[model samples]
Target: LKPLGFEGGPELVCQSLAEGPFGIESQADVDSVAMPLRKLVEGDNSSAAFVIACYSDPGLQVCREGTDRPVFGIAECGVLTALARAETFGVIAIAQRSIPRHMRYLRQMGLTERLAGERPLNMSVAET
Candidate 1:
């Protein structure tokens, strides 16, 4: 990030959820963190933009709606980055179960045509 001209470097905020799952591997886990993530985005004033680090991009829409600042999801960023380099792209998912959800998201974004394929690592988020 510093090399990208962010002189001070980006601040990494990891907000803990009292009852949230250890990792966001499922849609249920994503749902559990949405509101909290929204609140974090709404409350932040120093950052120029918000980046959701999770591959699933929990609360990306809600966070964007709650703030005027740019909100970027890692998944979206990855796809766009891949597109910038090539006509089609592939995804490496953490688990097979995640493929369906990711496929659904790609369909919703109207980017399914750009996706060449997706393969799972068959491991937990922690393992990755």
Candidate 2:
């Protein structure tokens, strides 16, 4: 986003976030590849709104509780954006478990109708 006049950077919460075939294990663990982003708020250059990029929405609720910043997640994000663009869209999930998870997320977003379909790849996430 920086190149497009919006500043953006990547943060890794922990090594294990990507060690498994899935990028993350549990929700709390999403705060990964071993970085402490929470510190940014206390020092300087603090941001009021934050966005996380996991379908799991990891550490999101906790982050919200811990800070005053607004947070966003990618999986929920794409569904929201797509709702504005199209009434429905296909989800190409990496695993069978992801189908229900994604479905649940869409439901949480109140985007059930907007979710056109779920097509699980039926394999480990890395394979697809």
Question: Judged by lDDT, which candidate is best?
Answer: 1
Among residues 3 or more apart in sequence or in different chains, the pairs in candidate 1 whose N, CA or C atoms overlap within 3 Å are: none
Which tens-of-lDDT digit does each residue in 2-117 have in candidate 2? Answer: 34353465432321333323455433344452234343323324455666665666556555565765766677677668777876877777656556666666777677775667
Alpha-carbon lDDT, every model: 0.85, 0.57
Candidate 1 lDDT tens digits, 1-128: 43455657776555555666787788888898999988877887888898888888889999999998999999999998989999999898887888888998899889999898887877545654
TM-score of every candidate relative to the true structure:
0.81, 0.59
Q: Going through the candidates in order, what is the number of backbone clashes in each?
A: 0, 10
lDDT of 1: 0.85
